[model samples]
Target chain A: MTPYDYRDLDPLIHSRIRLSILAILTSVEDAEFTYLRDQIKTTDGNLGAHLRKLEEAGYVRVSKSFVGRRPVTRYRTTEMGRGAFRDYVGRLEWILHSRPMDADQREAG
Target chain B: MSEANARQQAGDDLAVIRRLMEDARETVSNNGWHLVLWGSVLAVAEVFDYWAESGTLPVSPRVVWSTALGLGWGISIPLRRWSRKHAAVDSLANRILAAIWIGCGLGLMLLGFCGARTGTLPGPVTPGVMAIVIGTAFFASSSLCDRALFRMLAISWWALGSTMLIWPHPANNLVMSAGMVLFMAGPGFLLTRRAGKPARMELVA
Candidate 1:
């Protein structure tokens, strides 16, 4: 059995809201602020807080522009963010997949 | 948190993330009315041109085509506006698909105009060129989405286009008409029908 390491999980991407934002951004080119809020089912303030964290970590790029008279903010995952997401998800998958084997070994011992 | 409980929570979070990704991917679905509209219009125009060219119709082939083009524009302009207005969310895939078809449409129109001005477009090969243009768009769209059916449709179009190159003028139009109904309009209607239903999201394995 391989050793399980929780320390490998990224602290920045470990939270639910941040993970949700990354996951949603991964599947699309870019998404509007309202769209992300609606998809994540969070209050605007909360979504903004999480997005700010991600933006600080350089995991997302936020662009502000106007469509006619309305100002729009859109978020997209950066290349660095995509790499981090892949690694984060990969580690999570390994941990989840290895748990049953570790449990069986403990029982056999 | 205890180690075991923490591990369990991590697993749960991962599942939630996967589900969220799946749902996000499924949120944008195209109804494909544009495909049906253009396919039907083109098919009708081809058949009408054949009739006019074969001396069975009193009107010039140019008049028939002009009428078809005018009607196509009339319908397409409003429909596109309505679609943009009603769309719940715009995704990258939708934008790319629109660009592919619109670019192809403009390219074909330019080619046709050039050919007509130079008198280089023989009647027999018109369907062939149209088929190639439509096939290019289908191939591009199918590749973008990894849709096997549309890939097959693309191949079918190439084959139909090849047949058009060899077939005589009126007969080639008949072939194009049948091909449009069988390959183009048929799939379009199916896509529109499917889009009307609730999408069943499949989790990535």
Candidate 2:
């Protein structure tokens, strides 16, 4: 088998923004929508768009409720999503660890 | 609207949201953190009492680690997030309580390994008693952190430890260990499964 396979990997989470979203959700038991929004410093529309893509991929679960008068939303990672993230990170590590020797090393030899 | 006004409005909204989220998170459990803080103290003390009674641990090194697994499953795992929000103990109390428990464990372990007394027990009973006293103080001062159920396995540490203090027995440790595995760790295992589930409103309360 190949050392690394980026193929069939999640493009949605590949983006820096979505990656952070997954990272944060996976760390905590659960977090609120505004917490993610504030941390990511993204507009409501942008976050909503990214969340929709993740939700569609079944990587995140989102729920909404009302706290007294205000609407509330929360997000958390799925088991599959968590596993995929770990695998992605492992692949990244393998790539770095398995880099080919540079021209300088060849010349030195 | 002017940029200044927009900024002001956004700042106000941020403040409001932060408070709301904080409150929502807090509702995960009641003042249980205080109880947990006390519970840790109680755990350390219970360890000491075991030393005092046995002049040594009833179980071997492997058993001690296994018991810890059951205790954490029984007490620590289920209540961790609940403890995080309860804020029942002030920062001073938490650090002190945690320190006392950790110190008690390490101290006894050291005394035992060093063969300081060549006895069944390790460490001075005084330290363990002091830990219990401090823990009781914290427990008494704080209101119940959460519902009895919300506490899950942590309650057993308090109950079983106190029981051992009153009436010493090897059987009691069995009870304590059982309580930890059945009550504390069991729920935490279930919660871990849930943690991976998509965050939803129904789970918030």
Candidate 3:
């Protein structure tokens, strides 16, 4: 068996969509709203809802505007979010490692 | 029952799922400089073009350009908000960018306001001092962030301020252009490229 810390283990981070969101945020300095939407394949409301969750947690920040009459949006991760994610990944790896065989396994027929 | 319970209770598979999600998320995120860069480039170009075509001197030019930047800032907020739903704004990096966008937008607004009034703002010193002040603000803010790409952008602002204050180029916009190109766009383009390379790698791998 393995021991792990799950205090801030936001189940929000576990969702396939949100997890992907966090993952993408970790790689670059910042990203755009449209860029994230196209890659994740979720509807406008769906992605927005998840992002709002992240924002509430102080995991991400949002910025918006326009260029030549066209609108623009950008996103970036917070230091807290970054640190939390790294730790989450670390805990996940630790959790997945197989433990020593149980006594019953030694006697399997 | 003992062995089965032990294995099932561990729920190790959940961990695997999380890791996979992280990998997949990063593997997919990015829109490159296509949207924001093009917008910024066009906006800046428009301001430069107005200067070139009209040669209207102080009043109209600053008013027009500043108004334009103000509009740009207002527009960027919604654009950014909309993109979040699409997939681009779903990540951590992009979230931090929110503050940057706000800062830049506000800075542009301030610059625009100042520029609009600078003609009456008394001597060229006001404009120069304003440039230095705004430039210093951007430089300092960028410095506080740890990201290399951000630092590059800070240098660009610093260059613009220094050039205006010390070198005082009346005839050459090239110096400013070079500042954006070398410090802002150059590094931004490179970083965008750097970020995308990995997303493409899985396909090759």
Candidate 4:
């Protein structure tokens, strides 16, 4: 594979907003809608749009319920999402570490 | 973007993701007040039971334990209701923690009932078994939360539990009381204190 092949990254996941959502969701069991919006520092409209994209991709599952009579929404990553994220991270790491050693640094030894 | 620039951005993105994951993990709080409340109640009961057995009180030692258990249930029911009302999200970590404590509580209750029926459990043996159960719960929770403090507490419980098994009478009861304070109530309070603070960002090396 070509070194640092940015084109190879998953279009759905490579976007900054989606990546942030996946990153947060994968870390916990689940999180509320307000919590995600607050942490990602995005408008409700923007986050809802991105979350919809991720949900359509089957990377996230959203459930709605009531908490003390108020509607509550929570999000969690699916098994498929977790696997895809792991692969994405692995590819990124491989790209970063596979860079050839600098000639100057080699010569310094 | 050029290969060099692509690599740079990739590394930066990875770092940001790592930081976010760490923060999210930290936010998965386990309500520790339950542990603290139960531990305090049980410790008091144990001490009072010991005192009553020593002829310091005119009442039966059973009265102290029954009263303590009744008070514990009364207080815990309201505390649990309040927490549930305030909680907006029911996360997986919380569920796992709840399951662990619930299983432990059920097991203890079963053990007590069976022992009472069969007359197999001695007073000194009860504390040792309890310590082992508490230690197991702490160990599991520590691994799940990635916290070293709970692991250390688990070890403490195991060691203290073994000692309690070997000792008898007032000494065993005292050790059990001390164990509740140090391992359960102490960590519970620590969790409460830490809850108010913002999670620190951890970056990948």
Best by lDDT: 4
Model 2 misplacement above 4 A: A1-9, A101-109, B1-128, B132-205
Encode model 2's per-residue lDDT on A23-108: one tens digit a residue: 65665557677767665567788888888888888889987776557777877778977886676555444443443443235345
Q: Could you give candidate 1's per-residue lDDT for residues B1-205 as a string of tens digits?
A: 4456656866887877877776666554463788788889878977887888898888987788778778877887788777754554456787787788788877877776677667798777878888888888889988555368789999999988877776746578878888878887888887777655542332221
Q: B32-106 in candidate 2: lDDT tens per residue?
A: 343433345334544644554575756554355445535644664456544544221123333444454445445
lDDT of each: 0.77, 0.49, 0.53, 0.78
Best by TM-score: 4
DockQ of 2: 0.02
lDDT of 4 at A35: 75
Report how far off residue A16 is in candidate 2 (Å): 0.5
Give lDDT tens digits, candidate 4, residues B48-93: 8778868887888667867987898788879877776555345677
| Model 3 chain A lDDT-worst window of ten | A1-10
Native interface contact recovery, model 4 = 0.51
Per-residue lDDT over A8-105 for candidate 1, one digit per residue giving the tens place of the 0 to 100 score: 57989877889889998998877888777776777889889999999999999998876667777888999999999999988777666665677568
lDDT of 3: 0.53
Residue-level lDDT tens digits of model 3 in B108-148: 55654565466543322333444444345445444333244
TM-score of each: 0.69, 0.37, 0.46, 0.80
Best by DockQ: 4
Q: Which residue pairs in model 1 clash with each other? A: none
Worst lDDT run of 10 residues, candidate 4 chain A, spans A99-108
